[model samples]
Target: MEVETENKYLEPLFQDGSLYQNELKCDISEKISDILTTITVFGSVSIETSQPAIIYKSKKKIQAQILSAIPHHPKSIDTISISLRSKLPFPAISQSSFRGFTVSPSGFIVLSDTSQRLGIMNSCGTYDFIKKGLNSYNDITFVDDITVAASTINAIEIINLDSKLTERVISFHGICYGIRYYNGKLLCSVISKGIQMIQLSNGQITDLVKQREPENWSYLAIHDDKVYQTTSNYFVRCYTMKGEMLWEHILQQSKGVARGITVDNNGIVYIAKYNGNSIALLSPDGQRCRHLQISDTKKPWGLHFNAITNSMTVGCVNGTIELYDISYSH
Candidate 1:
């Protein structure tokens, strides 16, 4: 007996005229399913091999299609279908729009809303706690299981989840957009001032990278020993732990505003484009691999990668969140 195969081409619609002039396309050989998923004209699709899933925006919702029935022998993909398991309509964190989001190691989601509220969503996607009266919380990261540090305009606050007490840990004179906590230190991206490392113990500030010509960074992510930052000038740069430049890659369709950056365990960089309504993946060495369009997202802001579950959650400007099962193999 012989197995049959079919070639399927995934192409961007480009209907909104936001896609770059270079046509983005991918070819996959697989057995097509009769049950079609409704995808919108301006959505993004992420193909991952680690978990063998394809996540895309369909209409106003995001759906995950899991690929199964892989032949043990050398063969193409046979019978792709949508898995009944999915996360839809993430529990509302606030009445206002969400500006930042991060997932704790224990699987809880920390989100900041435009109305000065910080919310914690449990693994089941239900709000566990909501803390109000914050000063425009921008981004959040866990300093510990019961403690989280968040960024405001020019300050970083350490909040105790159990008691709901917020303390200003570090304050600077520049605008801070992105932050990450690691090894008792906080790495932050300050506009026009480059990246800064703050000692969590003493609240001491040290410049990691000074501002250079033509670009100011607003997003930061660290993987292994390397630190990553995305700039307002359409560039993604990598630096050593000692503040040495490694490589930089300029995005194809970025219109001078880039936000929401995260690095996977494999060192692949995923960034959200504020003006392009898209997300781009870059290789560890700064190579453009693929670009995805998120139709329902405007100015996608927060990007968080859950290493434990291999999931990526994105917060958009319209107060909605999209979660994807990111496969790291591919």
Candidate 2:
């Protein structure tokens, strides 16, 4: 999406005074209202808050309220403040189109681009290592501090930092998109084969979930012994390491496809919309906590969260990288 096109779609929402005011005035259930506020303020929000309340927020209007009519608890109205913080701009990590990115434990950023190049960026955002001539690298994961694994169209390539050499680790029959290293094995999404796990030591492939008729699984992440996979059909499905299906969430207004996906240590699932120029945060149980629109001109392609710095790095299709500091609590 271009800047003009994005503005054309968002202009009505920001310029229509009546429509904006009406949306702000609509009464929302207490539970949903609390969840929205909590997620907007803090990164994670609980889904257990169930009380009756009204929610209202506007950029042009200053109106806030909290009302309760329980016998012992009287109705209370208080001023609420919400602000959008400007994110810090990071130096360009790649000149070409990058499809996936990962942060190493030592703070190096490994980025893969459509030009069949994989480069590592230092903490100062300068390229420290660059390797070329690999096939379309889709996603990358760190097998260890000195070893990295990258997924290509039909195979997995293992690259060594010390030797600076690339090796074909395994070949797949389907298109590979997202990959992650978990429990000494590799968990990846193969479009025609579903989510598959490969034993790093023996190169044996195990089909965790068989692909169904209409679902196209693309990206995946691991957190708290659970695997989260995002599909091209705008759904995020959860599974156990053993292939047990847990839950699935269909993102509303997702623009028909989903892309980048990752999970925080707190079990917050972050997913990027393919062409929507937005990202959504979901709870562990598949509840929508927040939906964030990150760009007006470019689509967010890859996401990397640095727990040590409490920050997130978002890579856009236009070769723009942004760093944002995240708050864990209000």
Write down the lDDT of every candidate, Cα atoms only: 0.70, 0.70
lDDT tens digits by residue: candidate 1, 1-330? 122121112223333333334334565424234225442233444543332134334432222333334433321111111111234243554443667878887777888877788888776667755687547887888988888888887788889888888855577878777888889999888877888899987888999999743243377888988988888657788999899999988877534267789977667778887767777777778854567666666667778777887677777766666677664221
What lDDT does candidate 1 reach at residue 179?
85
lDDT of 1: 0.70
| lDDT measured at residue 34 in model 2 versus the true structure, 0 to 100 | 78
TM per candidate comes to 0.68, 0.68
User: Which stretches of model 1 miss by more than 4 angstroms?
Assistant: 1-96, 212-217, 254-256, 296-299, 328-330
Write down the TM-score for model 1.
0.68
lDDT: worst 10-residue window of model 1: 75-84
